[model samples]
Target: MGARLLFVAALTLGVSGLAAAGAAATGAERCAVDDLERRVCLEAPARRLVALSPGATELAFAAGAGERVVAVVAHSDYPARARKLPSVGDYNRIDLEALVGLRPDLVIGWVTGNPEEQLETLESLGTQVFYIEPRTVEGVAGTLKRIGRLAGSEATAEQEAEAFLDGMEKLEARYAERDPVRTFYQVWDAPLMTLNGEHLIGRAIEACGGANVFGDQPRLVPRLDDEAVLEANPEVIITGSDEESMDNDWLGHWRQYPNMAAVAEDNLYTVPADPLVRPTPRFLQGAQSLCERIDQARPGSGAE
Candidate 1:
C-alpha cells in the first residue's frame, strides 16, 4: 500500500508539469501601436531586435530589452554595452544587406529620422518594423511601455515609465508657480533654428516656468535670422552640447550683442545634448539641470 501511494503521487506531479508546459507553449501574443498609429504584433516576444536610430536603441535598453538587441544604427552609444553591438548604418541611411542578414525578429524604426522608402522596402522583405517618434513627455513614457510590452519586459518598462512621469510631475509641482523667464533655445547656429512650443524641448521649457520666445512659431523647428532673436531679446538662451563637460561655445556669438537681454544678463547656458535632445527616460536629468539654470536666472536668485 505504501509503494502504491508513492507511485500515485509521482504520476500526479508529472501530469501537472506537462499541463504547465502546454500552457507556456500557448502564451498570449504581444502587440503594440507605434507612433504612426500602426499596430505591430509579434507571435512571441522578440528574441532578436534591430534598432534603427540612437534614440530607438536607448529606448529599447530602457525597456529592459538591451540583451535582445542584435544590431543598432550609428551613435547608439548609451548603456555602454550598445556601442559594442553590430551597426547597420546611420539612422538616415541603412545598410539593407547587413540589416537583412542579421535576421532580427523585429526592427525598430524612426518615423522622421528614417527614410520612408527604405522602411517600406524592409517591410516588403517580410520583416516586421515598428516606428517610434515621441513628440511629448508623456509620449516618451508611453513609447517605453509599448516597447517593453513587445519585448516581454513590461514590468521593467512600466517602472521606468512611472519613474519618468513622477520626476516630471515633481518638477512641474516645484516650478509651476515660479516667475516666468523669457527663453530662447537655439537648436543650430547657421540658418539659426529654434523649436516651437510643440517640440519636446519647448515643453521642457514650459515645465520650468520659462516662456519660450519662439514658442508661437508655426513650424516645429523654425529657421530665423539673428534679427528675429535680437527682436525677441530673450532673458535666457540655452543650447545643447555633445561633450560631457557641456562647455561648448555655441552661445558665444550672442555675447557680442550685449544689448540683448540674455547677453546682458549672462544667462546663456548649455545642457548635455544626449539627454536633452533624445526622448528617453534620461531626459529627467536634462530637465532637472535646465530647471536649475532657469531658477538661477530668476530675480534675487543670487547668481554671480
Candidate 2:
C-alpha cells in the first residue's frame, strides 16, 4: 500500500513539473488588434508563422519576423528569403492540410484577399490568426508597428514605420500644392478600371497635385467605358504594368484616339506595378515614380 501511494505522489509531481514548464515556455502575454477589429493575443512571440497573402508576407518580414516565418503563399517573393519558404497555397485558395502540417504558431491573413472559411478553420484548429488590411498610407505604417509588437520585433518595426512616415511626409510636402493635373489612373486594361478617391492610389494621386477624374465615383474601383475616358479627357493617364521596362498595350490603344488630351500630349505613362499596387512600404517607391510622371505631364515640363 505504501509503494502504491508513493507512485501516485511521483505521478502528481511529474504533472506539476510539466505545468511549470509550460508556463515558463509561454513567456509574457502580447496582444494586437487586427483589421477585423478582433483582439489577438499570444503568450509568447511567434516562433513559427504562416503568411496567407503576398503582402502579409512582406509585412511580416518588415516586422522582423521574416526568420520566424515557416510557410507562405504564392508570389511572396519579397526580401529574397521569403521565396525560399514553403507555400501552403495562394491568397484565394489555401491548402489546409499543408498549412496545418507546418504547425504554425501564428497565421497572418489578408482581410480582403484570404478566404474567410480558411481563416476560420485555422482558428478552429487552435492557431492564432491576425487579419491585416491597410487602406491608407498611415494605416500601413501603423500595421507595421502592430505586427512588430505581436512578433516581438518592436524596435525594427518602429524604425521602418518612422522611415515610411517620413518618406510620405516629404512627398506630401513636395507635391501637395502643385498645379492640379487632371489625371486618370487605369488599374486594368481589358475592362478599363480606375480607382475612386477612397482608394489609396487615388489618395496618392491627390498628394501629387493631380486630380483623379473618377475621384467622385462611388465604387472604390469602377469600370469605365471608352466613351467615359474620351469625355473626361484627362491631361495624363497612368497605369501599372507587370514589367518595369515594358510599356502597357493600353497606352498604345489610347494613341489611336489622337483627340484625347492625354494622347495628344503624349502623357500616357506606366509605372512599376509592385510598389504602386501593393500596400507595403515599397509604395513610396511607386509614389515617387508617380509624382515624377505627373510633373513631366505638366505644361512646359516637356512632352514626348
Candidate 3:
C-alpha cells in the first residue's frame, strides 16, 4: 500500500493496541522507538524534560507534557507557554552546561538537526535522550504518542494523535481520487532547494493529489539552479513563508517565465512556513490548506 494508505491502516490498528497496552502497562517501565529505530526506555515516566528543537518542543507540548519541560532550544515558540521557558541554545549549538543545570530527566533531540557530539556528551552525563525525525505524517503521530508515553501523558497524546490522523484521513479521502496536478515546492530562496518524495512536505504534496516535480530526486532536500526548475515546468508552484499573511514575493520570481505552466495559469501559491515545515499536529492544518490550493489548480476545478 502507499504510504498515505499505510498511515490510515496503521492508525486504525494502533489506536486499539494503544488502549490494550495502556490497560496492561505498568508505570515502572516506559519505552518507545526513536526515529533512529533505537529503543529508548525509561525506568519511570519522565518528570522533567528538555526539548532540543522547535518541532520537538511542539511535540512535547502536544503530548501534554508542557508543564514538565524544563528547557528548550531557540525558536521553540508556540503554545505561548513555551516562549516563557528557559533556553539551552539553538538546535545546532547546544549549551551543555545550561541544559545539564536544568536537571532534565528526559532530553528530546533532533536526529538530523542536533549536534551529535553534544548529544553524546549528554548521554555520557547519564541523561536519557530521545531523538526524533518524523519523515511521514504517520511518523509524526507515532512520535507524539511515544513522547506522551515517556511523559506519562498517554491519554492526551493519544487523543491529539487520533485527531490528527482523522483529519489526514479526511483530506486523503477528499483528494486521493482527484486528478493529479504537477507541483514544485520551493524550500528556500537562496541556492534554490526542493524536497524529494521521502520528505514529509513531499508526502503532503502527494496526499493532496499533487505530484512533486522533484519527488524522484535522491536527496531529501536538493539544491538546483533556476534552469532545472524552468525545465520541470510544473503545473502548480508552491512555497512557504514565515509571514502570517504569506505576502512575500518569492513566487513572483517565476513571472519572468511566462511560458511556464504554473505562471501561465497563475497557479503560484504560498502557505504558512511553520505549520508546513514543523513535524507536529499543526501539520494537519497545513495539509488542509495545501489540499485546497492544489484543488484550485486542477483543470476542472475552475482555475483554468
Question: How many residue pairs collide in each prediction?
Answer: 0, 0, 0
lDDT of each residue in 1-304, candidate 3, tens digit only: 2454345434534543454366456647789988888898876788889999999999999999999998998898987899999999899999877676666768999999999998987776567889999988889999999999998999999999999999998888888898999999998888899999999999999999999999999999999988999899999988888755778677989999999999999999988889889999999988887778888889988532
Q: Which stretches of candidate 2 lie over 4 Å from their true place?
A: 1-27, 302-304
Angstrom error at residue 216, model 2 = 1.5
Task: Give TM per candidate.
Answer: 0.90, 0.90, 0.89
With a 3 Å backbone cut-off (N, CA, C), the pairs that clash in candidate 1 are none
| Model 1, runs deviating above 4 Å | 1-27
| lDDT scores in order | 0.87, 0.85, 0.87
Question: Which is better, 2 or 3, measured by lDDT?
Answer: 3
Model 1 over residues 1-304: C-alpha lDDT tens digits?
2454345434534553454456458885689999889999876787789999999999999999999999999999998999999999999999877776676768999999999998897776567899999989899999999999999999999999999999999998999998999999999988889999999999999999999999999999999999999999899999899756877777998988999988898999887888988999999888988888888778776442
Candidate 2: tens digits of C-alpha lDDT, residues 1-304: 2454345434534553454467557676679999999999877677778999888888889878899999999998887999999999889999877776666768999998899987886676567899998989999899999989888899999999899989999998988767889999999877889999989899899988898999999999999999999999999999998754756788888998999999998899998988888888988988988888998898866533
